[model samples]
Target chain A: MSPLQTTWHHIRRSPFQSLIATTAMFLSFFFISTFIIINSGLSTVLKYFETKPEITLFLKDGLDTATVENLQKDLSSYQGIKEITFISKEKALTIYKEQNKNNPLLTEMVTASILPASFEITVSEPEVLEKIYQNYSTKTNVIDEIIYQKDIITSLLNWTNATRQVGFAIILIIASISFLTMITIIGMKITNRKDEIKISRLLGASSFYVKKPFLLEGIIYGLFGSIFGFLFSFLLALIFQKSINSFFQPITFIDLNVNFYLILLFAEIITGTLLGFIASWIGAKRYIKF
Target chain B: MKIVFDQVDKKFGIVYALKDISFEIDQGEFVFLIGNSGAGKSTLLKLILNQLKPTSGKILLGDIDLSNGNKDDVNNTRRKIGVVFQDYQLISDKTIEENIALILDIVNYPKEKIQSRIDKVIKEVNLGTRRFLFPSQLAGGELQRASLARALAIEPEVILADEPTGNLDPENSWNLVKLLKDINKENNTTIIMTTHNNEIVESMGKRVIKINDGEIVKDYNISKKS
Candidate 1:
């Protein structure tokens, strides 16, 4: 038989042991990869929030058209500014009317003249929004109240960081359990083949030659298990894709990236191979006497 | 071409199994190791095979020192000496032909040569009809014949049979001894076996070496007349 076929024969002979060991490795690495992928996406989303525009400025009543135009030009070249948008008082009044139409009590109080012309201002970054607020809080007739949603920015960062920490901790715990489980399965296989190993040694086979089949078995277990785990995790990501899209609407949730998935695939195969090789090596080494 | 033990001492843990034992068997010699249980008969055989290192003293197969040789050299030496055990040691799951083929497989004989050699040895052992049967399916005599076929398949210069017929009935045992004698006569292969049976020993008409209390008590050449 070919070496690979021989390896499969041994693995096929003991299905239950192989399954349990492979499953442990699969779950450990799968959860770790999934947590990393999702948390990294969340971290990117948090970063995007921190860089988004925060404040808008409303011009004073009865301002000339040129003065409003001049304000846009002035803010465009100003320091600590990311972007500026000029909105006419009529457009502001229209937006105000449309928004408040559902609330009749507020619609009666709102009018075109009452609503001032405005320039929407976004600072260099969310962190600098407060700096911009401090810089222009007293600037004469340049702005009405400076408005930015700092609560959302702060909360996003805090949540992403917390989840990343928990993800890391869980990955570590699962890896340890999988390591122990794979090693145990290897030990059992060695015990079962105790006589065969002794006979091989007596036949003048080297320790390594005798250990080949067991080590190969472990590698195969890891490979098939990881591929299976990767498929399951991908399906899970797909099932949640729509909810993720709706919840983070303006900021699209990225599906698994092609490059990142390739890397994870390589990781799964290597992890499986190493786990099998190491566990079987350790187990076979103990029993395959020279 | 011959095995020689020069004042070998073998100890297992705190007990001395064989003490100051020395003997020589010439090339193509047919001999039997006769001793009671625990008389160091098996220990001497293991020493000659280099399976157990001598506690003190030397073992030589021809001119090569077994104790000082490296693993590769020991394996090369082993390839020249075919060994059979009392238990048959035939892997129960493998068929007779597969069991014989295993030795060539381990030694990495070319595939084409392995099949023909297995077929030749199977026929020589008169096990051609039972070649495809697994060890568990075969009777004790057939299993023993399979083991002999495996040992003979390698075509070694020396054949060491450790109680090859120990577990067999009289008819089967006699048949096995005759096969060994035939192989020795036809191929000039050195044959060494250990047995306690006096009737088989007397009928063989070969050299006999007896041991007692870890020492050689007797060594003699036997003839058919007496």
Candidate 2:
């Protein structure tokens, strides 16, 4: 018989045994892809946070309009300066008023003239923000202290990196466990077929001839497992997309990229094939002599 | 062509199963091996099939030394030998037709030829009515007959029946023996039947080789007229 035909026959002979191993492998891939999506989402959020202007220098009470213009020009030419935007006190007051409009008490406390003139400073990289602050702090004309949300950014980076590490570790552990489980199941099934295999060999069957059916069964398992895994991951991503959009709507964090889907599909296929091959190989190796 | 064992010795660890056994079966002869349980009848057959390797001496199948035969030679040897056992050994899940076709399938017989071959073998074995039945669905004699039909389907040079009638009733046993004799006469297929049935040995009136404690104690040929 052809290898494919033999494999189909073996699979039909034991449907439940094949299904259990494939389903376990499918879940492993699904969990792994879900972890990948979450990590990708967090990294995108961190990248968005990095792009916002970090330091804002508020000017003192009576600097002239020409002095402010000269300050903006000098800051623009400074090293480590990616961007320099002069936010006039009036424009800053308008933005703040719009933001706090719902809080009537806060709205009454802020006015165009009362707000300080500021130069919004964005550094090339946040790691060198301390040096940028020190350089700007030494300048006499730059009146008020630098305003930067360092603690919030640092904590976000830490949490995201930690999540990435922990998520990957957990995925690895689960994959390993599921792989072993599938192997055990396949091994048991192979053991049950010991009599049939013996009869085949004694009847003049080759090793390749005996193993063809089993390898075919493994391939079938892989195809079905990967399909189920992909469906599961896709459904999960769809469910999570709404929550992600609601949470990070201000930042462009929810990326529904087609490339990511393709990568996830590839991961599922790889997982399915490896799981099936390893399980069948180990099982067959134990029972099939030569 | 004839098969011969030349001073063959088989040992498992320290115990000898068949020691210094020498015998020959001429082409187209129906022979019976008679002994108590564990008298090395099965082991002798196994040596012929290369299922068990003899520790010393040689087994010749028409001058090919099977004692030192490697896997390729062993497999080639099995192609010409059809074996049936006391237990049916038919795959329980498959139909009687599938069981008969299995050996042919393994040997890569043409797909078009398999159906006709199965039909012919089942009809020859008088199992045409139950060709579609599974092993579990058949009685002991019918299962044994199905197994024999499967063995015969390959059209082998040698038919090895190991206690072929062990599980059958007297009537079934007689029918099976008659069937084997008929197949032997029609095809000139060399039949080596191992059995404890002395009545069968005498009734066949052919050749009988008796084994006691792994040694062949008696060899006799009976004329057909008697």
Candidate 3:
């Protein structure tokens, strides 16, 4: 019989041991896949926020349309400007009226002259926003106040960065636990088969011949456990689909996309296989030296 | 292949399993190692098998020195030798056919001829029609015969039987001895067996090496024909 067939027979002879090993792998893979998906989703949202304009440029009062156009033209030529959107006084008043529609008294007193016209500018890179303000905020007469969300943007980036670091650390820990668990389980199996191994070696079997089956057994455990974990997470996502979709804005709905599911499954299985194989290598090395 | 042991000593912590042992057996010779329990019979066999390194001596199989041999050299030496144990040592989960096939497989026998080899060896040991049976289904004699078949399947130059009949009836013991003798004569395979049974040792005596308390006391040819 092949090494694969023998490994399966060994597993079958001890059902409880096999179950515990499979479950250990299952939990680890499941947690890893979840972390990867959530991390991917949050990364998408943060990336969008980082590239969108957080700075609003209010135009000087009584500024002609030509001056506003020139200011818009000049901002586009800047090094980091990604987009420039112009809001005229009349249009600004319309937006103000729409925003205060629920408050009739507040809307009745608002006029075009009272509302300010502005140019909303976004940068290709968020960190260059300070440079943009220093270069043009006071240098241009057409510019009034160069308002920006330094506190909001910086804090958001920091939170996302911490989440990413913590998420990776947790995934790494799960993988380590999975690796250690595979070693312990395979070690127990080696002990159980100690006599068989001795006899095999005495019968002229090489060390590779004796250890191949255990290595294959570890890989099989990882493959099945990862697939199980992936499917389990899929079912969980399906059951909580509505709540997760509603948790963030519509832009983040892409987190639950079909493509992401498949990609996450592939990544998890590959990572699990590597972890299992290396763990088995370590276990086999320790015992098969005899 | 010839086996030579020169002043071999095997020690375990403060105890010596074998002390100042020296012996030689040529190809195709049948030698018996006779001693009481704990007389270092098994330890001597393990040294020949290269399972245990001697504390302060050298053993050579043909031109390959086993004392300081590399891992590959030890493995190659084992490939040229076959072993049968007292406990039968057959994997209980595997059928008789699988038990023998594994040895042939490890020896890198041609995959296409494995089944035929298994059939031939099983038949040689008089274990006909029992190849598909598990070890638990066989009697003590049958199990030992299966173990013998596994050893034979390797087609090794030397067959080391620690105690071929240690766990068998008188009838099975005689039958097994007869089988070993026939194979030795027909295939020119060296047979090194360790046993304490006086009747089995005296009946077909070829060369006898007696040990007591880890020392060789007698090395003589008591057989009348030799």
Candidate 4:
């Protein structure tokens, strides 16, 4: 029989052993894919929030248009201002009404006079948003209340950074476990077929020929393992898409694109193949000598 | 292929297995390596097969220095040499035909010619009727013939048998030796076999190399087979 057929024969003969190794690979891959899903979703939300206006200052209702223009000019002179725009009473009222149109109770009494005009500022650096707000809100007579999103942006960014680290850490731990487990499982496989390997060597088979079946078996383990893992995570995402969406702001939901799936599949297969190859090589090294 | 050993020394840990051992077997010669247990008979076979390298000397297979050969070169050398083991070492799961086919395929023999080649070896070893049987279903004598068929299928220049008749009865052992002698004479193939069977050693009367305590104390030619 051909070497590939021999590989199949070995895998076919040992169902439970193959299952255990593949399952080890499957579980690890599934965990990594799940991490990727949550991480991507959170990253998308954080990116959305990151682009919104960083700081908003509500001026006193009686402030004249010229006073608002002067507040804008003062904000412009600050070091990190990207853009500063003064929202007039009419625009602020229109926006407030638009935001509360479904809640007539909240909007029925609101009018231009009641709604304070504000300065909407976009900063080049997020850190400067707090600095600009602290300096202008406390000292200016024109400012009635400050509605800066500094805290929200800071915490969101922190959460993003922290989750990214956590995802990386988890992947690291999972990869280590997969590598060790692969070595062990492949080692056992080598031991099981030790006699065949010796016979092959005695027949003047090349070293690669002797090791090929087990290596292919390793690759098969990794390949099927990762494929199953990817499917598991995808199914979980589909089942819990709404629940996952609830964790983010109501404005945006997770978009599962074909491109993302394709990329994930490509990445996972490469990882599985590499792990299988390396682990199989190491394991076969010990027993192929016979 | 002619086999030559020049001042070979093999040590496992601190103990020597074969020390200052040197010998030569001309092409197509049938030689028996006879020694008691721990007499370095197996070590001598391992050295000839290049499975274990000599610590301080050289083994040459037809002018190819095996001690300095690379891994790939070693495989190339082994391809020209066939080895048979005491336990018959046939793959238990495979049929007798498949066991021979395994080696033929490994050496990348021509696809259309593999069947013919296997048939020829089976006929030579008188295993044609048992080709479809697995090793476990065969008797001790049949298994040895199947193993011989596998070794001959490769059409190797040298056949190294490590106690080929170790488990056989006198009739079976004599049959196995006669087969080796015929193959050696007909194909002009070099045969180096290690054995402790004094009856066959004295009766067959071919060339004999006797070893004791990691050294060859006797190398002689007896009267031809009667």
Highest-scoring model, DockQ: 4
Q: How many clashing pairs does model 4 include?
A: 0
On residues A1-290, what C-alpha lDDT tens digit does candidate 1 reach at each position? 44566567667778899889889878976886688668767976887776655676656677677877876776666577777777787788787777556568978877777777777777765556676567567765766766665777778778887888888899889877877777778778777767666655565556666678888887877777778777777777778877886677555565667887788878887877787678767766665665
Clashing pairs in 4: none
DockQ of each: 0.40, 0.55, 0.59, 0.68
Model 3, docking class: medium
lDDT (Cα, tens digit) per residue for candidate 4, span B86-202: 898899888999999999988889989999999999998888789999899999889988988999998889999999999999898999999998889889999999999988888
Q: After best superposition, candidate 4 residue B91: deviation in angstroms?
A: 3.1
Positional deviation of residue B131's Cα in model 1 after best superposition, in angstroms: 3.3
Cα-based TM-score, every candidate: 0.85, 0.85, 0.83, 0.85
lDDT digits (tens) for residues B1-226 of candidate 1: 8888889888889789888888888888899999998998888888877889999988889888997878877777777777888887776655788767767766667888998999899998899889999888888888888888988998878888999888999999999999999989998899999998889999889999999988888999888545
Q: Which ten residues in a row have the lowest lDDT in candidate 3 chain B?
A: B217-226
Tens digits of per-residue lDDT, candidate 3, B122-204, equal 88998987889999999999998998898899788999998889889899999999999998999999999999788878878
Model 1 residue-pair collision total = 0
Q: Tens-digit lDDT track for model 2 on A1-290?
A: 46686677777777887778777777777777777777788887888767766887888868899888887887776667777888898889887887667578988977788888888877876656677567778775657767775756789999988988898888789777776776676667667777877777777776667776776676667767777878787787787777876677655455778898887788678768867787677767766773
For model 2, how does the per-residue alpha-carbon lDDT over B15-98 read when each residue is reduced to its tens digit? 888888998998899999888999999999888878888999889987678877777777777877888878878887778987
Which residue pairs in model 2 clash with each other? none
Model 3 achieves a DockQ score of 0.59
